[model samples]
Target: TVDKYGDNSIKLGITNMLIGEYLHTIDNKKRLAVPAKLRDKIGKKAVITRGLDNCLFLYPLKEWEALAEKLSKLPVGQGDTRSFIRLMLAGASEVEMDSLGRILIPDYLKNYAELKKDIVIAGLYNRLEIWDKEKWSLYKENAGRNSEEIAEKLGELGVY
Candidate 1:
């Protein structure tokens, strides 16, 4: 299923190509400006939620809706599915961009990601991931060092 936005960007189900990475800072009020290049693609409103690896995920409304649909279809009898759904949905917050294109990160979400002043907003195809700058640096370093191994693992899944 493809959904077209006013700007003509097409979202094909869970596939939205969000590219580029940006460095930003959280203000005293916990607001961070969305990168200008990404502002339109992410839309005026989005859903923020806890993400893997101690980061936060920002999903455009349409993408979030698709993801929520998938999550809703997870087997209800499975404990792991229930837990994962709770973790993702319970922490979700609907946020709208301010006039300056900034979105306020809730305190709980901030604490969950351990976000301080320095932050990194990274484009991850379908979602934008917000991470503490220092943590992002560390993660990049570690991932870089293990890229070969990671690629090998992914190759098994036909991703290589």
Candidate 2:
């Protein structure tokens, strides 16, 4: 968008992508306080669901709806596609952030991600990935080791 000064700037209507990693703790009640920075992008009402790589994915309401719509369009005749649809759509839960910017995670999701007291919330563009602290560390380390190879693959796909 261009402001009165004729310079480009981001406005509310533009997509607000998420990007960052934060360390946090889950309370005994399984309440996770999302980092205020990330929380601002996701808003209050969000959707939590099983994610790839043994983590939980949290999406903003609008992003979730868009994803759900896309998921609904996939061909159900393929076994893998059907399984993926079930894994994502069926396992999704609508969650609301409380007054303290905390979202109470369901036991099923908590167990799926194996979330313990210490947790890592990684903001990846449109979604937030909730992972166990140890797992994140390991994943980050492994990914860091293979970043060059990963970048090559992305380059081949024209992602860079």
Model 1 pairs whose backbones collide: none
- Cα displacement (angstroms), candidate 2, residue 38, comes to 2.0
Cα lDDT of model 2 by residue, 73-119, tens digit: 99999999999999999999988888899999999999999999999
| Local accuracy of candidate 1 as per-residue lDDT tens digits, 1-160 | 3344323455465434787789999999889999987887898888999999999999998889899999998897989899999989999999998889999999999999999999999998878999999999999999999999999999999999
RMSD, each candidate, Å? 3.2, 5.6
What's the lDDT of the predicted structure labeled candidate 1?
A: 0.89
- Let me know the TM-score candidate 2 reaches against the reference structure: 0.90
User: Which candidate leads the pack in lDDT?
Assistant: 1
Candidate 1: RMSD to truth? 3.2
Off by over 4 Å in 2: 1-15
